[model samples]
Target: MQQIIAAAIQFNVQQGDVEANLSHVRDALARVADRGAQLAVLPELWSTGFAYRTLTELAQRTDAVVAELQELSVRHNLVIVGSQPEPAGDNRVFNTIHVIDRGRIAATYRKLHLFSLLGEDTAFKGGERWCLAETSLGKIGVIICYDLRFPELSRRLALEGADLICVPAQWPKPRQEHWRTLLRARAIENQLPVVAANACGLIGKLDFFGMSMVIDHCGEVLADAGERPGEVLATLDRQAMTAWRAQIPCFADRRPDLY
Candidate 1:
């Protein structure tokens, strides 16, 4: 069979504007469906645009945003992956990624590595769980912005049979090189495609450089976006992934006992 097509939407999020952000997210989902995409990915903390300055004020509305994504996924017959502030009850909050399929939450991954530089630790609770979801395409792994810098997380997912690792990020501009290099490295070492959706423009004082992209198993840039808001689409071929793994044999040659 042919590969599944996925879309990463590079959104220009307005800081602390939940309504506008959610509206853009819905528009992004519609655009993805119009392009015949099976899976649509949105950037990290999209519900409120990584507004750490006022995250607590916006935390209560996350559930409503998730409900909207669920409704959109069901209406469009597409898999939707997005992030928002999570109210963890008992007065704790987390930055969470939700994977919605067929109108239900298939998996939710809380951001394990919080960006301390962004003062994330002060505003949100970190997670102890690593999650992956199975879909018609294959096993899919998810992580938020800072999580991409940790190879161990992506490696663990790859070892667990994740063919595609989707990242929803609000990565900033100045360090664009790090974003590109890390994403390519993840795809190369894991032998799985990496789909990253990043936000662009300015969110408060932080300027996000939206280089949203799709990388193949061999670390090739399949589809890439610029520093502006847009959408990138790429066909993730299962057969190609199989062929790459067969040629490299990295997964089979692993010696986990030594580590």
Candidate 2:
């Protein structure tokens, strides 16, 4: 069985505090590493904790976050996925996820779908492209919080040969059901595993519910954090997924001609 231990680091993000938030994430990564996780995922806007007022102020240069992640990846010997506020070169800021594998950046995906209710469209620039990165485990696709609502994005990544999709989010309590349902739906419909890392506690006026989870291709919940700040670990079986895909033959049965 080709297996890898994946972890979702669910934590309470401190608003407007990059240094403290990074420190917290570092600790979380260390904890997951100690527990034998080959891949550790963090929540969206983790560095700044969804601070809308000072998003630009808290935005870090991509190089800075990447450098820190590189060091952490090498130290822990694990892959890391997370997002931060990034400058877009024209005074625009983007919510971007950087995939670091064994001390090197494998890929970066900026959030394509921004939440209008949270004023994300007004505050941050939406990404224009989708990305998938090949890793030691398998081909992995990345998307931010609101991007999970769009099945088209995940479907595109699945068609591009992504075996797993990682979602880092700061989803609030009011929409917790949406988060859980979407995660499972994406996994079942795409016939691939989905790892979601979400923030907990309060960020400004909004309260975040931390039900971070790892769902397999059949929509089974391998692990869940359950409304608390902690790490949820699960082992992914690539061989089993491959066999299941062969048996179901969903990908091979796709007919794009009519669509």
Candidate 3:
């Protein structure tokens, strides 16, 4: 199996400032490429911070952001996974994630589990299903922020043959502990690698805690970024992942019908 270098970009995003955010993202992508990363994961709602209050206005600009990301992906020869607020066809806005591979949009995942506690439901529409996208490395599954709390989603993706899961989040400070624990638990239980990118700094009433990290199948943290703006890079080896799965056989041993 081949190994691919990956980078998770953790930064402070400005709310409703698309141009400034894209500039920061461009710089991050360049830095990651210089470090030899072929894949980059960015924080949730990156273009607009976690500004749900202004989602209605910002949602209309997703196409522009996607265009910028597509160009960056091609230029860097990288696969990019990131989230933004987007308007669905029905004119309702969804918390959407996009997977860009070699300049093309590979897949778009709408966040299934919206955080109602934070008034997310009032501004963003909920998604109904999950998405797994194909890349040069292999099949990759993506979930935005709160979706990490649902182990069933991760399990389903792993059973469907995902080698790694990417989570783009704006996880807050008070629940940073939950963020770390849940991410590790998902990786360990599914026996697959996980890459998470989270934002740092304050946005209105929410203060994001960026402990972005990459965890291997055995529940070990391969690379971790502290509660500050930065980036972490790691190489994901498919051979090692395959070996671990063969040794554990958790998927093969599961009795889905009984549960």
TM-score of each: 0.96, 0.97, 0.97
Candidate 3: list runs displaced more than 4 Å.
89-91
Minimum summed lDDT over a 10-residue window in model 3 is located at 48-57
- Pairs in clash, predicted candidate 1: none
* Candidate 1 lDDT, 124-233, residue by residue in tens: 89999898887655678998999988899999998788979999999997999999999999999998889999999977778989999988888999999888788989
lDDT of 3 by residue, 1-259 (tens): 3787888999988988988888999999999999999889999999987665667788888898899899988999999999998886554588888899988889999999978887777667898988999987689999999899888899889888898999999998898889989999999999888999999988777788899998888889999999888899988888888898899998889888999
Model 2 gets an lDDT of: 0.89
Backbone clash total for model 1 is: 0
CA lDDT of each prediction against the hidden true structure: 0.86, 0.89, 0.88
Better of 1 and 2 by TM-score: 2
Clashing pairs in 2: none
- CA deviation > 4 Å runs, candidate 1: 90-92
